[model samples]
Target: MAESRSKLVIVGIGDDGLAGMTESARRIVAEAEVILGAPAMLSLLDGLSGRKEALEPDMPAALRQVREALASQRAVLVSGGDPLFYGVARYLCDRLGKDQFEVIPHVSSMQLAFARVKESWEDAYLTSLAGRPLEAVVDRIRTAEKVGLFSSDEHPPNRLARALLDRGIDYFRAYVCENLGSPDERVTQAELTDLASMDFDPLNVLILIRKPNRPDQASRAGRHRLFGNPDDMFAQTLPKRGLITQAEVRSIALAQLDIRPDSVVWDIGAGSGSVAIEAAQLAYQGMVYAVEPEPADVALIEANAESFGVPNVRPVPGRAPEVLASLPDPDAIFVGGTGRQVVLVLRSAYARLCPGGRMAVNVVTIDGLATALETLKNLTSEVQVWNISIARGIEQMDRVRFEAINPTFLLAVTKTPDVSD
Candidate 1:
């Protein structure tokens, strides 16, 4: 028979410490023969006697201490705020199994921060900068009406605010709430730019609320239209000006994509981000990733996405195939510029596409079309090809004249479902 494990109580304490804890929670801590928590959190309960084990930030060492303490004595683990809200209690529960422990949660610091700002955080984007890369989150912040951030020692409020400013995001009013529920608690509010240059206490939550009725900071001379906006509406760089997929072709490809409000789409070689921006608007509740290699095109993609007020579009500045690996698998993919790596990109994309996902590739040259059709046909039997030839009526001196644009080929494929199904 297996040895019975001692019951562990994980108690969440606030800055007020013992005073903030409930009578039941205080009793549990008082009866514990061993207690584990951060050194600072342990210091708050100096009045209660127990064998105190300092919980290190290193998770492995902390878990080792937890196991040793629980094996020999009645253990009570102390954490800050709600033990599960980005707290140590989550890790303990996962490692030790939820059935082995009881959790007593206090109010989280994030909750207190939101309260201090008098803002509703139900719809706000909440995240922490402890282990997550800052780059992965900055784009999400660009479109959020409100955001709550738990600042780490390495990525403090000032550094985060500066990072936001550098990305052309300056519409949010910043609030740094420091030392919540403590004697030195302070709340500082300012513009994001101003917040970037200031310092704050190490223990703080940074809240950002967008400026009232503020339009996107990026230029928006072009009118915002749904799918099928004219090609000239986008700000494309010279030399690559004529390379954009014609408006008509884009409209057809989008239809074939069968995009939904929550579909994840990819616009590979997304020059000036025209297609990606439009797709983002279509997938309003979803995400669109624009992958481009040239530095200039990447900048244009970002500018265009912002101008269209589509915060869902993320401009990934890198080549396809390789960069596609990092992104979430797509529900729909549009390949615009292949750089003669059409086969490689198609195969990689087809492999990563979710079941029943759609892929649309446009090619202007016969050789390119042949390769695309052959490649797509290998992925699934449901392949379609369209020859798009569009002309606009231009008023001549005496009559309306039709100006023909170059013909393009669009090939679409839907991934095959499981045969067993």
Candidate 2:
């Protein structure tokens, strides 16, 4: 009769390794027939009497090796810090099934790093850079008051600090914790600018604590109003600056677009592509075609897309109606500046839209609205027009006063299958 396979135990160790482990955890490691871990982890169990196996540098292969070993004898897979908090234990559980192993966790390095910095982590944005793109975690950190990052070999603290600083994100006080709980453990704190020039151990957690009173560090609403973001929030062409769609108008148009994560959209007359960029972010998996006629505006759109890191936006450098031919049909469309060609663009866009697709046209004057409404009446049966007037508060002589922006008209039309014929 074959011997029964022993259960796999995944144990988390602090920077102190076995010395910091609980007695029960130590006993489990000592009794294991096969011990699998990185060299650093293996060094912790130097005198242990077991069939010691060094884990591969590659995580997936190491996990595979661990699973094969689990079929024969009792094994302990050792990892540093909390096994589940951006650690290997979660990956193991996910790949091998939760029932296949028991996980023993220790304090995560993120928690230790935050503790070292004397900051509460309940609200911090936590992520790991290991085997992942830095851009994958940047958006979450962009507005977070606190951020905890498990720095990897490829994307270390210095690189991350530099990336953040380069993107005008200088609101955080960076703290790097190296070898937490070890005798040589060190926690270094500095401004993000200062951190970009420094170096630290490979095994480190990078904590970003937002500096007090920093303008960009404030909460979303505290920093700026919801509807009308500052014109500088977007990238615009130099010579044709301020020609981009107005914030109030874009806000109302976005609302009419009814944007969601799955929305497929088109921004005709994309200008600097503010609406298209924001819409792309809101509609993550969905597509946003930024159709612009001006080459400078198209270049600005590309620059804006890079800064925002929104991959969903496709900047098409050409006039609409003609360019709309090659693109996928949109769920919604926003016409920012159509001039006298407003009716023609709407008619073409309406025909290209899938049934139930929405199209919103922003008109600064009543004449433009009349043209759009007339075109909508001919194209589809239902059209809703809204005149949006926004007043932004300005602080003057210690008194707050409302500054009313130019009112704009938004005409929203929904296409119907029956209207096509």
lDDT of each: 0.85, 0.80
lDDT of 2: 0.80
Error of 2 at 93 (Å): 1.4
What is candidate 1's lDDT per residue for 1-421, written digit by digit as tens?
9787787788999887888889999998988898899987898898788888888777767777887876755899999888888888766775556777788999999999999989989999988777544654575687789999989888898898888888788889999999889888999999887888899988899999998887664433236678999898888999988789888899999999999866789999998988998898788667899999999999998888767778778899889788987786678999998887889999999887867789999999999999999888887876899988988999999999999999999999988765653
Candidate 2 lDDT, 1-421, residue by residue in tens: 9787667898998878788989999999998888888888888888889888889876547767977888857788898888888677765775456777888998888888889889999998887777444553665687788888888888888899888876678888888999999999998989888898899999899998887877663322234333456678887767867666777677778887887665679999988889888787667646789998888888888897776776667899888688887776677898886655777788889887766678988878888878888989998778999988878899999899998877888889877666223
Off by over 4 Å in 2: 1-3, 217-421
Model 2: weakest 10-residue lDDT segment is 217-226
How large is the C-alpha RMSD of every model relative to the true structure? 9.3, 12.7
lDDT, residue 143, model 2 = 70
Pairs that collide in candidate 1 are none
Best candidate (score: lDDT): 1
